[model samples]
Target: MTPTLGFFAWIIIGGLAGWIASKIKGTDAQQGLLANIIVGIIGGFLGGWILSLIGFDVAGGGLIFSLVTCVIGAVILLTILQAIRSKK
Candidate 1:
């Protein structure tokens, strides 16, 4: 069976995923480590969800796949956030 990830592991993954997403979204300058972690975790979830809806399984794709899905999700999140901010 695959080993379960610990809390720190999740944080690390989340931070990296978030940072990459922020950079892609052009919001890196406005965010920090904490924000990255938050975005990453949430993005991972959203990414996995979206991918699953599209008949993809990012969760089973390993590290690189995980990053890709997370990045996709983070970008989507940032896009929505930017749109909302623009409207306000």
Candidate 2:
């Protein structure tokens, strides 16, 4: 079965996750609302992909699951961004 989330649920979780990740990476000052949402949703996708690659079952989960997964991905994303910026 496909993992599905309601629109509002997705937005809420994504925003929260993104905000938290930004806080962790010290980039909260650089992100706006829409950017947070976009980063969050994409982070979710990235998290899912990473989990799948690691042979973890990432389906049929709840908010905490999604939050943890997205946070991990967002951390990775922010780390990559910082690395690229430092190289520039």
Candidate 3:
């Protein structure tokens, strides 16, 4: 499964997760496809890290879990960015 879920899978999952997150965060209008993909991948990493800190087993989680993690992280990331931008 690991081998099958390669770079392309990451991109697909990230893109979808990011798109959903952007919509959820109400920032979809401000982002492009590339941005979504980037955010999603980064968000996935961030989410995994955060969940791991709280003793969540993120690694063994399946596709849906991974997508949820990515979406959660993307929303958090977007919220932080929005807050920072608003302060400016």
Between prediction 1 and prediction 2, which has the larger TM-score?
2
Worst 10 residues of 3 by lDDT: 1-10
Per-residue C-alpha lDDT of model 3 across residues 1-88, encoded as one tens digit per residue:
1222579988998899899999999999999999999999888888888888888888788888889988988888888899999999
Model 1 residue-pair collision total: 0
lDDT of 2: 0.82
Candidate number with the higher lDDT (2 or 3): 3
Q: Model 1: which residue pairs collide?
A: none
* Candidate 2 residue-wise lDDT, 1-88, digit = tens: 1248888978987888889999999999999888777788888888888987988777866778888888887878888888999999
Best by lDDT: 3
Which stretches in model 2 have alpha-carbon errors above 4 Å?
1-3
> Could you tell me which residue pairs clash in candidate 3?
none
Task: Write down the TM-score for model 3.
Answer: 0.92
Better of 1 and 3 by lDDT: 3
Worst 10-residue lDDT window for candidate 2 reads: 1-10
Backbone clashes under 3 angstroms, per model: 0, 0, 0
Instruction: Encode model 1's per-residue lDDT on 3-67: one tens digit a residue.
Output: 13567876888899999999988999999999998898788788888888888856567877777
Per-residue lDDT value at 68 in model 2: 85
